[model samples]
Target: MADRILTEEEKAAQERRGAAGGAQRGGPPHMRLGQPTEKSQNFGPSARRLLGLMAPDKVLVWAAMAFALVSVALTALGPKILGRATDLIFSGLFSKQIPANVTQEQAVEGMRAQGETKLADMLAAMEHIRPGQGVDFTAVRNVLLLALALYAVSSLLSWTQARIIVRVVNTAVYRLRRDVQAKLGRLPLSYFDSQPRGELLSRVTNDIDNIAQSLQQTLSQLLTSALTVIAMLAMMFYVSPLLAIIALVTIPISIGITAFIGKRSQVKFVQQWKSTGEVNSIVEESFTGHELVKVFGRRDEVGARFQAVNEELRDATFGAQFISGLIMPMMMFVGNLNYVIIAVVGGLRVASGSMSIGDVQAFIQYSRQFTQPLTQVASMANLMQSGVASAERVFEVLDAPEQTPDPAHPETLVDPHGRVSFEDVSFSYTPDRPLIEHLNLCVEPGQTVAIVGPTGAGKTTLVNLIMRFYEVDGGRITLDGKDITDLTRDNLRSQIGMVLQDTWLFGGTIRDNIAYGRPDASEEDILEAARATYVDRFVHSLPEGYDTVLDSEAGNISAGEKQLLTIARAFISDPALLILDEATSSVDTRTELLVQQAMANLRQDRTSFVIAHRLSTIRDADLILVMEDGRIVEQGSHAELLERGGAFARLYAAQFAGALTEDAEAGQGAVPRGVPVH
Candidate 1:
């Protein structure tokens, strides 16, 4: 039969047994309830720290900025060149002796009068005129060539700037991902236990990618647009300050609109990211527990729950993007209005002869060039804000406090003789309630110590304390006269080996799993360890023997075989202290016997602690301690405990009463009702 799942009543009964045992060991209540749905809102410090990571690449960044300036300068210069050419053409056309508008006969008469006047003036000053005084085509050609050169240079500079921006952004993203991964690795195990794996994965993958994308767009567009606008505006004012002022009126209005939309968009984008994490967490949990859902026939319900989260994410993202999208169009609208105003005013100025037609044309062109980049800058605000949000998420993990290492001057433990002792050890999961209270216990090396009690009797807590998974609240646990707290955690744990009931195997071949505990172990040593744990039989039964690859978590293997493999792993460690908590509970009677025999061989010279629910397994233990609550209620040999007729005797009787009666009926030797098996 499968081992019974511990009920609340059974757990309480075991606690009572530990209490009656007079030596108590306790622990925090197990947390079986689902975690609550809440999100954190701590992005300020994380943002600051993320910005600091960019300090090293400032030089290349500045160089990119310089190229951007040159590109903008040339872009603005293009319109001024057209304006100058327009002025030259307009001057030549308007200088003729003709009215702004006239009939054909009047235009002909005017042209004939102007030609006669021009010929008379030429006759009067013909001697003063020289051949070299005609138009200079060379100078005109030089100016056109300069304009072409400027266009080419601007295109090259813009391309180089884009390349540099992309390079910098990608490099920064690479470093950020690396730092985030490293930080996750250093975080305490408790943090992982408390947080959802999907949430963490989302932060590393989705959030970082968002930041990278935003950085890519924001970096290139924002820098290029800002520089272009500045250069364009300068040229605009140089052509006609009045027209430039008229167009400049749009700047403040555009800024105000952008700022308002950007602020609201940032809030929505944060919500979007939070919703994404929630959806990811739900999906991850559903996929991981697909078997459970299938067994319970709740696939539709699960799908509905996932759909709810997915819809929430979709709504949030749409809201954020929609709001951010408004900035560009609004800026463009204001820009077009300013463009009309500049054109009207400049046209009047040119008509009144206050400015040349070329100046009006150039001013209009410069206004358009300036407004285009301004609109681009306004649009990029959303990308910049999104990147900032991602940076905040990434930095959150990087800034979290790491697990503190032991002090530099830790006391060394030498030649530990495995005399385990807990002196006044106390602990709690929460400050309000204590789990263990002034607990004490002692066991010598080479002793077979059996810890018996109901579920949650603090049996596992006691072992966790020895391994330093957590530090004691108010006392010390010593091994061989050395305080465990004084030794490095790694050093303390290195001396112990454990085999838990839940065996986990990474995806690999059978030989890899067996050799994990001692990577350098020879084939003979691995075989010996496997033999000691009787793992060889199951391993050899596989079609490919040791070369067979196990499924993820070793799901392809039987529970009993997996348990045996774990035992083989611990046996290979050859630790001074060994712990077996429900180690053989999953196996059948025959497999249990084999495992028990192998365990007996492996524990011959080591200090072993066995926690068994089956009374028969601990019947031959050198010392059996019955626990109630968190204390030992009885301690003695199996026979001595039976003679006491206490908790141990009652437990033994409950497990094997039918067998004892059968033996009695068969006329074989049988002990009394309260007598323990020996």
Candidate 2:
């Protein structure tokens, strides 16, 4: 057999064709919208899972169930009481029998006469009825009292059930939020590199909220509606099976209509959710880069892009809602159909003396009771579908594979002596594109190692390897005498500190930011660390000193100040290994000097890896590694590399050639005739 391919419209047309064919074949006509799927129809699994969340509050669950049961019982009883009253009125009117072979006109006149006589008797009875009239008023009073009691009790129980449902839902939502946050915290850094910040936020905030809404409203309503329907059906059958049969004929029809609408709504809802995420991403991008857009004179362009996403979101939402909205009207139409059928069929049965008028009336009431719950259950399908979609997205993150952890029996580096070595290590961010290859180097404890290279020369990759931010593909790296992989991530990272080219500061007081690396550090220690980084002068200049509140992302602070604060944070930790990647790149010369001084203080007992473009900064390094294309092309101290006249020497000449020319123009002494500028 060959496979068949169909476009979306073709598939829809095929469904309609199939539905028409099925109807022609004498099968039940299939509805086009709100159709339930195999996955959606089974509430057992989701219900059981939700029930487990409420297990801790067993008493509350029991109480809610008890109230719900009482409510259903009372609701069922109301119809029975009304049915009995109807039966009593008919029986009293027809106490005197009529002839079996009566003309239709004569039968109608007899019924009318009986009805007027019954009304007169009822009025006469009411005249004698009075409040505090003892037993005379007891029967009427009892009926009235029972009706009021049923209403009051059902309403109260419904309220109690509502409270319990809210409690369960709220607690479940809280736990789910916590679980998502914990998963995000544990996720590898690389996972974030591939995902957008806005998308992640949408999952956490919007998707989770959708799930919570379903739990709060939809799930409870479905369960209660199901229970009410079952109770109503059981009563209908007990009262009059034939009428119950007529009433139940509407069930399949109602379900068919709902199932059709629900199916269409589910697809729309998924599209709607996706559109919402896109809109969120666009909004987040626009707001975060508002200044960039203005500077680049692209504000209108950005606004247009945002508007496009916003309009897409609106269209998707409207489509989903339009599809879902069909459910209620379809339900009402089916319900009315059932009513008409029950009225016509039941009236014929009454006329033929096969069923009582009371039973017919009761069946009609039961029909409404039945369809009402079915309608509710159908309506809640959208919410349930939304929750399923959200759960899939959330679980996509939760179930993401994590990086392997260190072996349990692996070697430990106690009080790391700061000796580091890279042994022919090769690595690539992706398999096809190698970033670093067959590299070998060693750094001694307390030595400042300067790594110089052109852009994309693996300088940052080297620092990343030392920190074990990525695992090497082919060889090994060692800290002291132990393989870097042997140490736990926490233990290994605690021994290192870094100040990157782009400084990141979280919202907090200046004192808090400084002490971030050492949370338990005292106020004095925090202040001292800040002073060592030359951040204290800035802090004192502010009206609030160290207590000044930093807004989100440290927006209130300048870039240089942010860099200094990050330096202060790294200083407070006092790690054995330090990596500074263009740490002073953003600062002015004055701020650079303060950072250099801070760096000096921080490097006292630490091994440091410094990547610098400003060649003057690396002049005093114990060793300099010049890299290109993922390999070390030259390695030596500043003077010896200059003597080698290779990659490093050429890089040095290029950097200083202009300065040398300027010096010559100023009549400064040139390099000695025999001395090598290299």
Candidate 3:
């Protein structure tokens, strides 16, 4: 077959598709960060759901709100209380102007009769005034002390409310992280197959942290700000309704500014997080495939990809912050305008004697209080929007459909013989494209079956069915005459051991990595498994021997050593069934022979399924199955299939064609090239 060349655009698209596929494992299409932001459609519902995370702590939240309310009420009442001192001082000054011989009422009436109506009214409105006293220093002192006490109490309540809110936020976020972790475990393999790892990780870590911060910073402040707005409005109206009306004119304008900027900024915040996920995906993939990238000299391409996604993140974050930032200054602008208007109107009322100097003073203070909270509310819109965006992303993971649960009454596997059979099984990763169909196979308890085929020929898929990593769309598989589906996945998997082409070892001792298959294994069992797999041969050369700790990536060990350790892991389990998918592919030819010998020993009396592309590795198998496009086209011993001269013959001939010519030139028997050498 000729290789079809791709157009430039097609190549770019393919790269993007590859990047998307590499984004971890596959997940929901909407959650994929390949195309960029997945904006939350309903802000109200998302915000409500985010708040609902704190439902378990609602009692604490309500207590905090109550404290904030009382705190704000006290704060709002402070100016009014202070206004009393002003009234007392001014009233005493007016009383001293009157004659000491006249009574307080008579002085006021005489002043009114002498065409001093405004002064008479001002003096009449003053309370607790002695006719000849210049000022009552004791009353003034008491008023000052009372105002200070109210402020001190309000500060204490504010601190208490803040502390409660922080605890509630921490608790709520803790639960959210726990729920997400549990949800990830319940998700099906297919869900992970298409998802990007970095993107999902961002949701789990970055998004959750952002949620906590948003709640901690804004929840209490929002509660206090809201209450302050209410309390201040009431105080303003009580002091003078006309001035209060003038102050209210800015409320609608502030709302308009917040609504407009908040709407645009929300979209940017969504983009910011999505771009962040994409950036994470790129970095993770680049790091994981660093050697391959260096070999291919794709460093420039990777850097460009990172730069592009990072630029998107930068733009998104900038846009969100810049737009949301407009709210504060804009609100302050509206507030200042309102403040100027209220000051002018309040002063006029005081001058006309319709309102006392202290009353007008309190009214102006109330006006300032009302506008300040509105400003805070406007500024908080950014944090709320960003947090809601992250919350919705997290909610998506929690809402993903879970894998089918294990049966309520799970069947237990008895002291089992590993006789496995697939009964006309059919399956596909997607509904439109069927990969495997009507496949039937059975391996006896002690048989070693080898599966060989080209890539994408369902060789690995067959064993996966036996392990129940995925369920068949049609028919069922069985072990020991019982349907595998009836058994819990853990129970079924417990009896099988798998060593794949890719090796995985965590940051732990070599002994720990080997014992991972059966943590309950004794020290002797671990050492025995290590010896059986040839892992002991190399461990003695290392500085720490079996105790040597592997890094997270296991970079300290060679690939062949890593593969050997994985094999020892399988050996320690001593499972009834064993699966080796090109398990020796990573080792050198010398190491491969040792591994094959080790495997041979481990396979004694075990039902082992070996998937190999290196034909030499499976030549001695008791049974060999030739698969193509999801069906077994041929099945027999290696020599039997080579003599048959069919698909297996063609594959064998193609692989060893050059070596056969060299053998013929060396004067060996001119037997058919497809024939297996004994």
Write one digit per residue (lDDT tens) for candidate 3, span 140-176.
Answer: 9999999999999999999999999999999999999
What's the candidate order when arranged by decreasing TM-score?
3, 2, 1
lDDT per residue (tens digit) for residues 480-585 in model 1: 8888877887777777877877677889998888888778889998999998888888877789998889988688888888888877877887778888787788
Which stretches in model 1 have alpha-carbon errors above 4 Å?
1-48, 85-145, 354-362, 412-417, 601-604, 620-629, 632-639, 648-678
Q: Looking at candidate 3, what is the lDDT of residue 483?
A: 93
Off by over 4 Å in 3: 1-16, 19-37, 93-120, 661-678
Runs off by more than 4 Å, candidate 2: 1-63, 89-137, 352-354, 409-414, 653-678
Error of 3 at 646 (Å): 1.3
Task: Score residue 678 of candidate 1 by CA lDDT.
Answer: 50
lDDT of each candidate versus the true structure: 0.73, 0.73, 0.83
Candidate 2 vs candidate 3: which has greater TM-score?
3
Error of 2 at 90 (Å): 4.9
Q: lDDT winner among the candidates?
A: 3
TM-scores for all candidates?
A: 0.79, 0.83, 0.92
Better of 1 and 2 by lDDT: 1
State which candidate, 2 or 3, has the greater lDDT. Answer: 3
Over 1-678, each residue of candidate 2 has an lDDT whose tens digit, in order, gives: 000112122233335643553211111222111111223323345446544655777787678777888888888778776665565555534433324354334544555677754433332322222222223234445665787789789888888898887897788778878988888766654555444456678878998898888878875676578778988899889877887888888888887887778777767666777667666766786788788978999888767866876787788688878887888888888889888988998887766656666677777787788889988876776777677656656656666656676689776667887999999999876576677888888899999999998866777778777776668998999999788898887788888888887787778898888888888999888988988888987888887989899998787878889989988999998788888877888889988888888888887888988888887778778889998878898888888887777888778777778878888899994752222473
